[model samples]
Target: MGSSRWIRPEIYPLFAATGVAVGICIAQLVRNITGNPEVRVTKENRAAGILENFDEGRKYRENPVRKFVRGRAPEIMPSINDFFSKPDL
Candidate 1:
């Protein structure tokens, strides 16, 4: 009786929040799959806008060990400028 009345309001908001989260996740998944924003800069001549913010996380990993071990090594992820700086090609 009283419990049922209390549950309805709570459950509706929970369901609505879940639906919003799922919608956002699906939208991001589709965006990544379509390469609309290109999360990684695979080639030099491809595009530059994708990697502009890639180094924004540098401040948090000032230590050498933290920088290299956090799974974003330079070899594995050369900076955006490196793509055009290398003379060897």
Candidate 2:
């Protein structure tokens, strides 16, 4: 019983190391099978996409904010103009 007890403690570390190695192998196999590599977004490709969209008939004035601000022009401009207009005596 004494020799068996001495051997059991030494085997725990070997079991733990084997478990870790198995986990790493499984993770690598999953990565290989999925064929999904990490996506790398560089500034050059992002800027090129944006430039292409802008070049392909996308104008700043066509933006929703510009349309909305222009839509509110009559509401805002008339108020300011009314305030600054000469008051009749």
Which candidate achieves the best lDDT against the true structure?
1
Please give, for residues 1-89, the per-residue lDDT of candidate 2 as tens digits: 66886778779999999999999999867745443223225656545543334332445325566677774654657867877795867
Q: For residues 1-89, write the lDDT of model 1, one tens digit per residue.
A: 76886777659989999999999999767756554444454665365553554354353235456655776544755776687777873
Q: Show the colliding residue pairs in model 1.
A: none
Clashing pairs in 2: none
Clashes per model (N, Cα, C within 3 A): 0, 0
lDDT of each: 0.63, 0.60
Off by over 4 Å in 2: 1-7, 36-89
Indicate the residue-level lDDT of 44 in model 2: 61
Question: What is the alpha-carbon RMSD of candidate 2 to the true structure?
Answer: 21.3
lDDT value for candidate 1?
Answer: 0.63
For all the candidates, what are their Cα RMSDs to the real structure?
18.2, 21.3
What is the overall TM-score of model 1 with all chains considered together? 0.32
